[model samples]
Target: MKNDNVILGIDLGTSAVKCVAMSTSGGIVATTEAAFPLTRDLPGQAEQNPADWLTALELAVTRLGRDVTMNAVAIGLTGQLPTLVCLEGAKPLPSAITWMDSRADAWASSFLDDSKRQMMYDRTGMPIDGRYLAPMFRYHRETFDNGVGTILSAKDFLHFALTGELATDPSTAAGYGLYDLDGANWSQELCAVWGISSSLLPTVRPSASASGLREAVAARLGLPSGLPVTVGCADSVASAYAMAGLDSGTVCITSGSSTIIMDSLPKPLRDSQRRYLLTPHIADGVFGREMDLLSTGTSYRWLNDLLGWENGRIDIAAARSQAGANGLLFSPYLAGGEQGALWNPNLRGVLHGLTVQHSSDDIARAYLEGVQFEIRRCVDILAEDSKIERVVLAGHAASHSATMQMLADILGRPVAAYHHRSPAAIGAALLAAPSAAHSKQMPTDKAVAVPSQLRADYEKIYRRYCAMFPAIAEAAD
Candidate 1:
């Protein structure tokens, strides 16, 4: 039953590596995932040996069965971006930094003056922060002062590994905080400002551009050499492309290790307030309006681990626990910044109205509510900027019925959860396909309607959630 018409999509995410085989008919043939193993090791630092990511990707693709590769016409790559990687061609000079690290803060502050920082934000659609490439690169340039390597994002490294081509997509490049959004290329002025050469970065390429896979790499993975490979986008963008109908009027929420809310506009939207991140979408002239929440699924997973709920058992607690988690209110901030908020990396999680009477179930449910409430807040911000009548939810958090229902009720809008477990990979596959005309990635029939029962209840608690952010800030302080 092996067919050569299938394309492979590789998604290297924060918690895992997922490789999916999708057929020409747009149906998924197989998928496999490998969990994270590399270390955070230090506070404000997260590093992974790049080799581990490749090994994990190989393992997942390998598990898709030998036939998938034998049949895989092309491989599309996507992963976390703005993470630091110093590369000596195919070999990494140092461990790849995860997006979670803030070791670039001092470098960012020293490199960007207030005026230049504002220019960078306006042009790049990203704030001057440690999660960006400029600061991360500066940290390496100042610390090790290494002159032996080039800098690339995680997916760029993967594409280089596969195709021997050092390149990045406009979508990926826009997140680096180095590229010129208006010019759609690397900014020589900014490079001069940072006292760095443009040679340090990858060449810009279209997202769907393809190259022949390298012989050695192909042989290592048991795939044929000269296989076609697509230069894919970042995970959030890919998820939006794969799952959401972004041709105006619709918004997408990719709820995974983080929560990413995005919309598509005819042109890029710049926020002088520095509240949103803008990036080019897969479609020409269309922009992806994006915001991030660092700990959405992570928050839910954290509570699940605390409650000792295994797999599908989590919904039971979340579903049974009434709205407002029985009077317990929670704000999920298990990590650094809760992007789309005040942009405070020091923000902490808060659980108010918690009493001995509340069980772990109540706490878990409360955490779920907290994350969706944050999404509601983000969508509201987006509405102020543009019109969004409907929403499409994708990723791990979106799969749960309770979470979807909660989101729909809280937002008071129709919320469609992606049917596919790996929308980003599916998205990459579409980009890898030989022809642009393919089956519908997201059929409207798959959408779910909002439940009316919980809207009023959630509206009441949502106000309470909004009121708690200040108190949460005080508690964190």
Candidate 2:
């Protein structure tokens, strides 16, 4: 029989809300998910109604309650980071601006002076990009006429919705471009430069600290009032925590709508070239993490869309039919470019080395290879300072596909696939687990590993793909 003291972890994602209930022994009791749409008003504008997240959270929690015993001890929340959510008191001033939105490119570009950019990067471990918080905040202050009282990231906003408390964890704040990793607080220098006040930001809190929940929210979800809510980290950090391998040499690679490669570091390290970003870990002030963000599974989605294969299901078997993709090479930069190598948004997608012999299968294989090549680039960058011994892969795309074996082989490292369905929720649950004083000690769970057979062939293709990037970059130029 399960214990009455349960912990619930909620992941309020850009596309969906997922909730997981866990027993005190670290066993998953009940899980539920509810999805919402991303509203694209214009070519570059990606927004979501904040009300949608609240509605999804209510439904997901309500569903969880119907299937399980109502004994949630604590709740932890995690989701997409750096998305700007403008709020006036409790209400939203504008729809949540998603992380993918790049309307602030012009605003961000003007601050590209080498010295100023380097200074900001040195303090924040983040580059001056439109996807970051500073640029988004600037956009809101300068463009929006509506009164704005506070700014919260997607997960932070959801936390506020649930707890009626405005706060953010260090992991989420690190990506905002306002956080000073060296100082461990919001940067007054950057705030002054951007002409924004620091008071508008939420209070910074630890990842697992008890963020109080509101009675009204608990009543709506059929949960107990005053349930202890842990201020959770970003999805990547939370996913890393769920993997439970936070040693110095281990890396966590999440291949989903995007590929995020992050590894733990005892202290901050900067490169002369300013390639990678270092962010605070969930256990802030003690550990830091390095990240390389790129489009991974998104490339596959793009190819599938191009082939009109939108049957809403991925046909992996068909993709295996064309070995080596019949010499096709694709550059997977559909949603613009990411870290290390920034490309112009106007740069068109390419299908190089196409021939009359090529088929849809070839395109699919090439698409997969292109994303792997990007991952290899990130791995190479991180290897500059950190000795990455192994990589733990998480996310629906990485867990479901045999193609991930190709990625493991290409990187020449063991790739362990952690729990597939929803790691963010599991990570959140781990974060919300009652303190040792409140429950018995439970053994930590390890991530599930992918088979070794898939790694061999994938390594061969990865080597050839890596050799092809210079020429591809030249072509794009």
Q: What is the clash count for each candidate, in the order shown?
A: 0, 1
Tell me the tens digit of each residue's lDDT in model 1 across 1-477. 377478888998887888888887777788899876757777777788788888887788788888777887888888887677787655786577778776665556566667876888877888767787766776667554455468888899888888888999998887677788889899988777666678878999998888899998888888889998888998878888887635776888887777888888888888767778888887678888888888677666766777777765666677888888999988787776556655665687778899999987788788778888888888888888788978888776565778788888989998887767777887788778777534357553365868678899888899988887856666654
Predicted model with the maximum TM-score: 1
Worst 10 residues of 2 by lDDT: 437-446
For all candidates in order, the CA lDDT equals 0.79, 0.72
Model 2 misplacement above 4 A: 1-3, 67-69, 286-288, 292-294, 308-315, 318-323, 340-348, 437-477
User: Local error of candidate 1 at 53, Å?
Assistant: 1.5
Off by over 4 Å in 1: 105-116, 436-439, 444-447, 471-477
Each prediction's TM-score versus the true structure: 0.94, 0.90
Model 2 has how many clashing residue pairs? 1
Candidate 1 lDDT (Cα, whole model)? 0.79
